[model samples]
Target chain A: MGAKRIGKQTWKPEHPPVIISAAAVVGPFEGQGPFKDYFDHIYTDIMAGERSFEAAEKEMLLNACFTCLNKANRTPQDMDFFLAGDILNQTISSSFSALELRIPFFGIYGACSTSAEGLALAAMLVDGGFASFVLAGTSSHNASAERQYRYPTEYGFSRKPHVQWTVTGAGAALVARDGEGPRITFLTVGKVQDFGIKDPLNLGAAMAPAAVDTMVRHFADTGNGPEYYDLIVTGDLGKFGHSLAVKMAVSNGGFDLSKNYQDCGLMLYDTRKQDVHAGGSGCAASATVTYGYLYRKLMDGELKRVLLVATGALHSPVTCFQGNNIPGIAHAVSLEMI
Target chain B: MARDPKRKPLTVDQKRYTEMVRDLVPRPPYLRNSLLAFLFGGLVAIIGQFFTDIYRITMNMSVKEAGNPAVATMIFIGALLTGLGVFDKIARYAGAGLVVPVTGFANSVVSSALEFKREGLVFGIGSKMFILAGSVITFGVVTAFFVGLIYALFVF
Candidate 1:
């Protein structure tokens, strides 16, 4: 199902104009290991050198925002808010970032789905007659995330291919409401789901069901079928999880997602670049796909209606020890030109 | 004047073009649109309920399955907000809307780090890598510890 935006040129709804001005990626999985060598290269090659993962992440996001605004010919002063987040405590990444922009800030936490959730909130604010000119974003890092979630690198824990590759990078996009840009007409809120899977190591399996659940809900709520949108994209659910999600959706939801399905993690690294057997995290997945694929498609008029689903593995190490598989969840949003 | 080979190639034309383009494009009035995006985003969620129903009735999926679609929808809406350029707008209007929920924080981190990548790897990629995820990781760890602590304190 694909949506074709009608009357896009002159149709500016009460909603503000929203468009992604620019995007960027920074990471270190370029040449780190044999199994996941190339993933580190993105960091080595794209970013240049290494630093504290947290520091690097902060720099990456700050740079992305600056570049995005620069591309749009706007400045931080032009923005009403400085929105940011990360998979960290106290949202240090975003908090620190706020210090840089010195603009009013909002910090959020949605696991990997942070990017999507941020966008949804911002759009709702626009639709509700609230303030405008907001900036929303999300990010992650391999070292920091791994150390926090599991054992530090010194522990030398072996990672399973089924496990998702934690993307040590950040991505950003500038959104504006309703004039001379893509207009977001709708968004579907996600319902949290725990499929009783508790393995933190294998996130795809944990998150697949959640992705299916949210997608099913979105379609049901909209009264739209798979035929309604052109593409259905999921956040970090990589190869295994992506496959599992499709199967679950068809078997459980009675809808086949094979025709129009993609995962951000799957897209982030060329399997050749990184040994990421599955998918990447939220920001890398969101940023790359949004800027790499979706943005281009929007520009080309190749797609009219798109159902983008970002999935997250909401699991804690404590839960894992408690004999829990990763808890998975997903959220949906609709993007239309009209 | 002799140009130093070590000075690196500088493109004045690209800089000039970027400036020209910036001045040429008109920025939107974000105050109004972000609110609309929010409304539209909410409406999308409301509409998603119908999709949830379909999953339940037609497909015999569980409430969880029915609701999964909306998760993706929500994230897409977030991206759309960023695209509309109103995400920044509303972030200014309502702080809670962006921070309290899981989504808003995600965007803040991802968007901020992306901006820093241009400075190059040492300064760009490596430096700005985990800005957003740091929180989730911390929360995951601390929450796990507390959750574990509680289990140990009570169940164990």
Candidate 2:
């Protein structure tokens, strides 16, 4: 077993890393959304009895990571590496949680694509015999995200029809080389794709092309089309971006993603009822859905193999305000039941 | 001057793909949005005008002085509406139309404060009470002061 480089941007690991345990913690809003039962803990309030939404986000991730470890009957000392990320300013939420956990930490930032990136990186590390037990996770809080990206939720500004509400949740999973669970087999790192979209509101449009790019590349590299996977899940393209990505895949990627394609953003919330304008985005959007609902379905024998392509809009509020076009990235991780 | 991170331009095919993507995705209903904005905005304005008229008729002040009180009164009404959780409902439909008025300013200030009421008073309310409108109010005051200073100089 050596370096698992298959083609350009694709990693076919010699030994797939097993997802031993997964945990998700969400706020009241997320708890009320579609997949409430899948989440381990959903606080009745965003604060989670903390002072600020930032503090709440940190708490949520810490709790989720703790749950992940506890489920695997492992302690903090058992973890070889803790990989985490968030959409916070400087990724403060994950940073603070890492500091508390005291594991060999790798702080990641892939915008909303963070969860899949963490899983991909953790799996690679585990497969390469670098680390045995890796905890990979990410967190996001709607209030904290709003305070940072848009106006604070309290501002009562008119909600933009195209803007996505950042999910108020955290998700964590334990990945190991030797375990009896679902395994990660392939990872296709995305290229930076900028379609020259400048509007912060049009995030779905901004990230759709990147998702389409990585997805098509994954199919080409693996020599398997969309029909191979039980589900093709994108991280957080939301409603419009998900639709646009499907359109691109059909025409450009030479495959129809209509049958198996389901976006994490769309799955977590009933769009018609929830006022989550565009849909849910942020690290937690994909994180929770993957670690909770998707993993549970895999365990329940509903899905055998799934291709999770997490998309990210890599634009800071500064870049958006500065009138620069948004750059997008997507990472593909193929998962299978062992 | 060069851009710090100068990204390469998309290829001709990628550009075409992007156009196709933009077209495939639905544009938000601009016509409905404008209609809602107009209807909700007009209603808010009518309510504000009613308050202004009341102040004009009742108060023993000039039209200009009455305007100050009227605006203040409207802000008070806005804060009250926000506290009752009614202002947000109006804003959802009214968009920027309602936000351009005195009520919108009040909504911005009060909403932040109220949202953070759980975070305790000093840092939450005292410090963050004006997260949204603080800059706008500051700019308005500063600009007015400078303009007023110049106008006073000219008049005197």
Candidate 3:
């Protein structure tokens, strides 16, 4: 199918305007600097002591939320709504982070795609005249995640090379009333795909098909080919999944991925150095690219049009044992600075 | 209460036999532990490709000749290591150690299922089922943008 533009969802600064003033946040777990140096230690502290998930999330989010608000020269109360989520069971990180803001809150669950999803939803609400301004953010913690999801600290199991490093930090973006920056032009909610590969340890290979599906759809929906955007980014498919995604795009979907880059786990981390197995986590993949790469490039005026395709793997052990396949989903949010 | 022996007092040997329970646990030979990892690590690295190949073919399929010597060689190596149980041993030693690259991944799914049998369907099987694969999605997005971002900065 040719790329088809959905409803008129374009937002220019001059039009019934909600401007995106500043996009900033505290982390992304990138540097071996202060945040990384103390990540494991703080994570250990939270995991070892008697603390609720809420408290831990609260501690992490405050640092990031404050950083974002400080950067925007705005306070939490200035935002009409605070949108956020994490890999936690109930999005405790965002919920607790919201406690201090006292702004109307909306908690989201898009896994790693939460960044784009949050931004897209916030944009839509602004464009639709539901609200004037909104702030969106997402964060993830490695220590809290490892214990909650997999084996505990006691059982020392060596990680595989293709594993993703769960990000230890957080990031936030501010969407304001007729501000300056790249505007959200087009967004296509992805169609979920499943390959029936039921191994949690090896994720990249499993998510390739979904990434392919979404990329294909985004192009088809927009009627814009690969040439439209300067870059096409897919959220964490890891190294293995990234390769598979490329192979599928070229060989199966008939699109060349040689030019496209992925934000998978393996691509983000040096497994040998960090024992992350793959690269980084869902939040890390998006957070790093959004802050570390995308925003930076946008600031530099390197390119005007870009497409962010954030992919996610929706699976739980119970579903796998129930003999279910891994369901993959991707959301494409197009960014263009005018 | 005095022990009431059926018929007669139990003899020491009989009592010992009755009280003695055979330990079914496999004892580790210190010698086998060290050398096993190196051997198994190589085997795992080679066989790990089987999972990769299958996944590649299934998702990113290439319609090359199905039955070629190269393919045979790959399968032969996979079977040889799998039969030696070297891959399984590596899995036992290295959590992602074996699973990280490829062959170990299959073992991870199977082993994790074996470990948390009680979480039964959801927690044990379902949760562990596609748990870490999010990394793939995470990286897929990152690299796509990273490449694009880099292209914007340098190449573009």
Best-matching candidate per lDDT? 2
TM-score of each predicted structure versus truth = 0.61, 0.90, 0.63
Candidate ordering by DockQ (highest first):
2, 3, 1
For every candidate, the chain B TM-score is: 0.51, 0.76, 0.36
lDDT of 2 at A133: 96
- Tens digits of per-residue lDDT for model 3, A42-152: 233432232543355456566666666776688877888899888778888888778878889999987777877787777777776777778878877665566555653
The whole-model lDDT of each prediction reads: 0.63, 0.87, 0.60
1 versus 3: better lDDT goes to: 1
Q: Best candidate per DockQ, number?
A: 2
Best by TM-score: 2
Per-residue alpha-carbon lDDT of model 1 for B1-156, expressed as tens digits? 232346333256334423432343234435544564466446555666776787789988899987776565555555556545566455544434453344454455445444454567688547655555566778889999999999999996
Q: How far out, in Å, is residue A37 in model 3?
A: 14
| Predictions: Cα RMSD each | 25.8, 3.4, 22.9
Return the TM-scores of chain A for each candidate in numbered order: 0.86, 0.98, 0.84
The residue pairs in collision within model 2 are none
Superposed model 1: Cα runs more than 4 Å off: A1-17, A28-50, A154-157, A322-325, B1-156
Ranking by lDDT: 2, 1, 3
Candidate 3 residue-wise lDDT, B1-156, digit = tens: 232235345456334322221121123444554465566566655554564576557666553442243345544543344445454544556444344444443434444444344466888667765444445556878999889988899985
lDDT of 3: 0.60
